[model samples]
Target: MCRHVVPASASRKALLLQALLLISAGMVGTWCVQAITIETVNKASEVMCVRYWIPNEVGGGCNEVRMGNKWDIQVTDRWKAATVWATEGGCGGAHCNTGPPTGVTQFEITVDGGWSNDYYDISALAGFNLGLTVAPTNPTCASQICTSLSTCQGVVPGGPDRTKACKYGSASYVLTFIK
Candidate 1:
């Protein structure tokens, strides 16, 4: 009679490979859930208002985020899309300035699925009031920074070109105002 024994390391590697295969084949009974965080860092000279909304859903109204302050949005599971804006003044009442000249910084994100590719971008089409940067926690992903109207996209006379897509198990984004 002949018998064979497998090394512990080899056995562990085989188990890992089987798990990955199961996950990819959707045979595992668990769904992939990704945690996403969007943090805003205000580095401007004055107080700035930040607003975010998902399409077809009621959104958070403009709120003041003072210099050196931060605002955060946390989401779990899958989200279709969200748009965030950084503006100069408050909404309604006496402030109510949500347009250009002072400019408005726009950031958009879309997470299709935990196993699917996610997308993000910074647009100055609305205007370029403040310098903007989008930094992803995943170093394998790319970062986008637009410090001027000329260097940004979505503006008139130019086509959209600042979008990026990546697959991250857990995603974290930091939006910084560089002005």
Candidate 2:
């Protein structure tokens, strides 16, 4: 029986081709995890209650954000949506809810997972308890801001208006709660 051997040049070429294919298929060099940092700022005159959670997970409950302070949530390479609420009162209060209910301001964000673009929006459809603004670090991405309850769009029966999107791994965001 005779044994067959591959030449060094041919082996290298084959390996290079395999690598290129993997990269193109988004398998090789795709482990570069990108993150979007969402900074929630409390510009209200009093302490604000905040709650946040990703899809299929329960939030840690209402956390108080002191006036002029900020809370940051970093979303890494995950294909889930993160929802945050800023309310005048804590959870179980007259003004807040564990979920996005009426009278609670909500900010929803879906970070890029290397395959799709990032989407973000501020919704007053639940009724406005606080003014909200979602500003992305990328200038190319537009900001979603609603500063007045009367001027703010109410429930559209579906979703928020003026949803903004940015390139994958492009920008972090700042969600500000104004007075």
Candidate 3:
């Protein structure tokens, strides 16, 4: 009679591989959720409606499958915004009427999942007019001093403060992600 026995290490490797396969197949295992908050300081006189979306992000706004231009760096999750001010408007959300405009405003959203090891951005675009500051907020962000996008974006995250410009309805801004 002939018999064969599998080594413990070999069995362990097989089990690990199976677990990986299951996770990749979306069959089992859990995903990590990350939260991102945006504080929109409305320095403008008009009560503004803030709108934003994370493109190519693994979330409801983007609703894209796990993907990356460089690799399978699936970093981010289902994102939904919670208005801390009187009105909410973004990606087809509604706006609530408010009597007066508050100089300071806030927006909060939770990303369902993400890779903490990687870096992502939370930014506004060419259309919005809300002064912005990221927190762990940089107090000296304005002083960083950049006359161009390349220079501004080149600054470390949270280093470029566009809140002053955005205060009075500046069309464009450069903001670092507030982790």
Strongest candidate by lDDT: 2
TM-score per prediction, in order, is 0.67, 0.70, 0.31
lDDT of 3 at 103: 37
- Encode model 2's per-residue lDDT on 1-179: one tens digit a residue: 12345566787779878778988888854354676677889997577778776766543345678888988876675636667877774444543334565777788777763347887777666677878877889899887767886655332234545656788788888988987
How far in Å is the alpha carbon of 64 misplaced in model 3? Answer: 27
In terms of lDDT, the poorest run of 10 residues in model 3 is: 63-72
Rank by TM-score (best first): 2, 1, 3
Highest-scoring model, TM-score: 2
Q: CA lDDT, every prediction?
A: 0.68, 0.70, 0.31
Candidate 1: Cα lDDT at 58:
40
Give lDDT tens digits, candidate 3, residues 23-45.
Answer: 89988844544333333343332
36-104 in candidate 1: lDDT tens per residue? 778888887578777776664443444678888988877544456666767664443533232222257
Runs off by more than 4 Å, candidate 3: 1-30, 56-131, 137-179
lDDT-superior candidate, 1 or 2 = 2
